[model samples]
Target: MIAAFLLLLQAVAPPGVATQVAPAAPSAAMPTASVPLPPQDWSGLPILPIRRSATIQANTSMYVHGEVMAGRCAKAVRTAQGWTLTLDLAVLATPQGRFRRVTPRAIDCPTVEQYAAGVLVGTPRDAIDLDDTQTDTWYRTSMTFTWAGS
Candidate 1:
């Protein structure tokens, strides 16, 4: 049983270095531009948890409310508690595991975009992990802000 367990562990662990393979030559019939790109692989990237702060939550709620009231965004659905704001973002990380950039998808609300970027920027370095083989890559992530009691 112990030998089998050790074999399983070895299979699960990443190899010290990845083997490289050359790309196949393109055929004359198919154009590279027409080929659909594969979706990004986010398996190894860290998923940072949302750290809620009362002050930040209050400010974001106020900003969201103002945006809704000013006709900037469609009326937000409000529950007995309050409204929820979600931001989808792509974060670029360097080979050294440092976060380089935070890009938020255009949601028509500029302040909200900035808020999401701010949250990503405030994340500590220790929270992210990167392997030397990853190089520079963009990882997709999201944050949802939910305020209760308006």
Candidate 2:
């Protein structure tokens, strides 16, 4: 399943774009269980039917599109997990439009996943084909978050 998921990511990713999975770290107080992702189905394909450029732009906008948080740092930041997180997402077609679903290839922190999902879940730039004959064409996307240190 892991191999299939990686291959799907490679097959659908845009040119020059790379897919990375964040590594997990051990913690004295962290839980041993893992977060669950949506089950794989025909809708699990990585590439979306929408224009790739537009989708890319929208996804990128999620990071720097909000208010600036300058010079307020030097504050103590701590987590039971690693500071960086990488997540695999699938944009699926829905009656309302597009829905973002996380296919948790690697998730070390539930908080990080929740934060990312809140920022990410939304309709795609273009509508996906809803035809019954469609192969459930899905888009594969990844997001990585890295702290200033560690």
- Number of clashes found in candidate 1: 0
- Which prediction has the highest TM-score against the true structure? 1
Model 2 TM-score on a 0 to 1 scale: 0.36
What local lDDT does model 2 show for residue 10? 51
Predicted candidate 1 versus true structure: per-residue lDDT over 1-150, tens digit per residue: 324433443354233311111122589985643222223554465544334422354665676677666777653667777877777776666576555556667688766666556555555555555555456666677766666655
Global Cα lDDT for candidate 1:
0.55
List residue ranges in candidate 1 displaced over 4 A: 1-61
Please tell me which predicted candidate would have the highest lDDT against the true structure. Answer: 1
- Looking at model 2, report the run of 10 residues with the lowest lDDT sum: 64-73
TM per prediction: 0.54, 0.36
TM-score of 1: 0.54
**Local distance difference test, each candidate:** 0.55, 0.41
**Can you write out model 2's per-residue Cα lDDT over 95-115, one digit (the tens) per residue?**
434342434333444333433
Candidate 2: list runs displaced more than 4 Å: 1-44, 48-84, 100-103, 122-136
